[model samples]
Target chain A: MDILRLIIAGSVDNGKSTLMGRLLYDSKSVMQDQLEAMEKHSRSQAAGCPDLALLTDGLRAEREQGITIDVAYKYFSTTRRKFILADAPGHVQYTRNMVTGCSNSDLAVIMVDARHGLVEQTNRHTLIASMLGVPHLVVAINKMDLVDYAQERFEQITSEFSKLTQGYTFQTLTFIPMCALQGDNVVQPSTHMPWYQGPTLLRFLEQVEVRRHTNLSEARFPVQYVIRQQTSPDYRGYAGKIISGSYRKGDVVRVLPVGMESVISAVEVGGQKVEEACAPRSVVLRLADSVEVKRGDVIVKPDSLPTTTQELEVMLCWLDNKPLLSGNNYLLQLNSSVVQARVGQVAYRVNVTTLRQEPAPEHVAQNDVVKTTLHTDSPLPHDAYTCLRENGGAILIDKTNLATVGACMIQ
Target chain B: MGTHTLDYLEELESEAIHILREVAGQCERPALLFSGGKDSIVLVHLALKAFRPGTFPFPLLHIDTGHNFQETLDFRDQLVERIGERLIVRHVEDTIQAKALTEPSGRFASRNTLQIHTLLDAIQEFSLDACIGGARRDEEKARAKERVFSVRDAAGQWNPNLQRPELWSTYNGRVQKGQHVRVFPISNWTELDVWEYIQREGIEVPALYFAHEREVVEQQGQLMATSGLFPQGAAAAIRRRVRYRTIGDMTCTAAVPSEAATVAAVIQELLATRVSERGATRLDDQLSEAAMEDRKLKGYF
Candidate 1:
């Protein structure tokens, strides 16, 4: 079965956790003993149902404050597919946490309260999800019970959401109206809403086609390590995962940055000889000649070569408390490669609400999304983030504190 | 499909292998924390797949609580010998003796907390910048909030609020002089996923995971093995056919009644069970509501 990684995003009181709990509970994935524990620890229970939100609030501070601060992953499997849900915090100050959750997700579940139509937080989350290239989106207009299960409210909310995502490139956009607390239209269809004619949220998640964005035509393998056998002095193997594309024995390949060409001598996965290996599989390959290949070097097909340059234009999401200024140096870590780099120019900051580029600021603070240029001390092999995310994404690490300060998507 | 697709197990394995390579590529000195349990055993198997044909860059470290089962110890030694990799064993007993620590005395006393002292000491002794553990987020609540590369201070304290944001697959492994990062490659795997992978790969674990006749001390709907260190004064020990869901200090880990002699049978039983792995088998976690979070703050794994 395929595994689906989804993130639930909303404002603080939009019931993201309740939706997750309802999903697990209704699917019967919540064990009996765990349910009993949750009930025993629950301090408040309204409407005679257990406080399902307590199940995801695992930390002490979160339990005390009754809010989610970071991302917490929960796992459950149905007959059709397995799901890995990332419950991200909804507060505006925790946008980095939301970005972290959206980075690897295949789908985004944007939660909205029907009582209040699309708000600024909803727009921000939708924009971040679009920026991160989440293929599918399911906008859940929650709390239908509070809105008297009105069909007009649901339609109004859906219309506003459609207007907000006018120019976004989401592959699939679905809108569902439900009450997560009353178990209506989440796992089971609501008995109160006879006007609605759509699949329940669970049904949509189970049937949605989430394609793996692995590019097989243009192979890109960044060498992570070099293995040289001690007993067999003649054996040298380059070990790494194929970030994109495939490799076969006897195929001629090029090693990047070093500019050496060699024929593929052998291919091995998990220590056994294989005829070929594809993207995302960790394998070791032997070159016909010893061409001085080392870690941080990209091995790819000669015809579809990646950009080899020292300057790059990138869209960066600043994640640190310290402000990011121009001409500041940090370590840029790409897939299996790290190089010293400096922030050259802040071109523009994105106005998330309007999806427009504003004037550049002197310093960018935490959770600021900016388009900028980066200069590396050494040549880097990369692709556009829109083309191949695996080869294009990079993170900036602080030089003194060693914290990841920025996430850069190569433009 | 134009692009080649992998099965769910294969995908999880690939993700884990990628994380292992990151540890090898980033950290200068790292160690794989090995136990005789199935999770760490699977870690060893993945390590072989990751760095085989070449020797492992780091050694395997085990913080023995001195309250372990003999079968697990023997299995550890044999596996290390078979792989021909360096094994570093640090004893919590030695730490207790050297530091004049008092052992918890009760019906079910455990050295679970004391093992942290030895683990922290081993890190400083070897100057290990990274320690790859077999912790899965699906196991417990606090771990579910943990990052794949969890950073700890020089004193080995974990401040959940200060956790650095981990985005995508890129991990920041840089740390200060006495600090180290705890990397969990199998963070995404659940208990069922681990068992399914074990069945798929045909990896061997300790014999205790299967059903066997042993004398166990029954208490509070839990069954713990009768060991020398266990104070079994009033509670009667009886022979029962049981199996362990997890492997830990004998004083703390419990067994469940089962007839799962094979991996497939165990996976089948897991699917039909109601209680979670830790909820059904661990004795130490029943101490309080925030037991794991508290232990993590005090440098306990």
Candidate 2:
């Protein structure tokens, strides 16, 4: 079975955690001991129900506050597929945490309450997921039981969400009416909603074709570490992960920034020599001639080379509590390369709630998404994020604290 | 990497290898926190794939609790010798004597907490900037929320609320002069994934993983091997065919009754079990709801 990395987004009390808990519990992922503990904890509360939401609320502060503060990862598997669920916070203040979770997910499971319909949180999450380039969207109109299992309510919510997402692009959009609290249409089909006919959430997740999204035509390999053999002094193997596309043994490759040309004499993946290495595989490449290649260098096929530039336009998400200013100088890291970069210009700030671009502000505060220009000290070989996400993504590190301050998607 | 389409195992392996290399490329003085358990064993194997044909940029560091099984120590030594890598061992007993620390006295008094002190001291002594651990996110609740490159304070304390936002494959391994980072390379792998990888790669583990007849005692619904550390030779002690699900201090790590002797059988057995790896084996986690979180905040691995 393949892997599916998914993120579940919803507003508070929208039953996001309940939906995740139902999926894991019905799939036999929750153990008997955990069930017992949940039961014991449940009895202490007033509701006295099996509080499945407590499972995802791992931290003590979250449990006490009864909300998710950070993105907590949960894992489960079935015979059909393995799942890695990024349970993101629903609060508007934690938008950066949601972006962090949505950055690597293959699909986004967005929750919309049937009663409230598409609220500000729903549109914000959808916009952020779309901005982060999440391929698929699953709009789960949860808590349908409270709506008397009305098909019209589900349709109304779906249409509203569809209209809200009119400007965005998703490869696949699926609508499911689920009562996560009642275990309806989550792991098993719902009996109350007889009018609704659709695959359960688990079934849809298992059958989603997400692996084809990997870019195979544009080969980009960012050199991470250069390995020199002590036994053989002349062996200089470029160790790095093939972020996108593939490289063959005899393929002529070019070292980026330096523009040095060489032929791939050998490709070693997983410690074994292979004729060709594909994307997402950590491999070591042996060049015919020893060129000036080290960490923070890219090796790509000469035919499909990325744009090498010192000036880059990117969509930046401010994560740190400190606002990002125009003159801020942060350490910009793209793949293996790190360069001292300065924020050049803030073009416009995209309002996450309405999905609209407004005038640039003086400073981009926490969780604000803005289009900006960055000037790096050294030239970087990168692709547009829309064309190839692996090579286009970057992060801005705080110079003072060494903390990751912002996330950048090259445009 | 061999086939055009990688299975889940291969994908997980590739991701882990990438993380391993990131630690090597980012940090100047890195070390692999090796315990003789199956998870760390798989970590060592992945490190070999990551930096073979060239020496690893890091050495293996083991924080011994002194309440270990002889079999595990022997296996650790043999593996280090065969791999021809540097192995540094710091004993909790030595730390206790030097610091005049008091040991917890109980039926199964674990040195698990005391080992944290030894680990921090060793890190300071070696000035190691990066410590690559074998912790999996699927192991515990707090661990599920941990980042791949978890940064710690100068005192080696983890601040869960102040974690950095880890985005994409790009990791920020930068640290100040006094701070250090704890990197988990196999954070995505589950317990079953480790066993499956062990079976697939033919990675050697201690014989305690397989079923063997040994003197055992049942305590709090867990089957623990009878050892000198916990001298419970009363009516509760009985000989049973058992195997350890996780290897830690012998005083706290429990065993389960199983007949699986080979790696394939162990995988099959794991597939049939409903209890979690740590829940069924480790006793320290049973103390509180946030046991792991509290321990992590105090610098316990």
For candidate 1, the lDDT comes to 0.88
Q: Model 2: C-alpha RMSD to truth? A: 1.8
DockQ metric for all predictions: 0.67, 0.67
TM-score of model number 1, chain B: 0.98
Off by over 4 Å in 2: A43-49, A61-69, B1-3, B231-235
Where is model 1 chain A poorest over a 10-residue stretch in terms of lDDT? A61-70
Q: lDDT per model, in order?
A: 0.88, 0.88
Candidate 1 C-alpha lDDT tens digits along A15-49: 98889999999987788878888988888856468
Task: Give residue B229's error in model 2 in angstroms.
Answer: 1.1
Error of 2 at A57 (Å): 1.6
TM-score of chain A of each: 0.94, 0.95
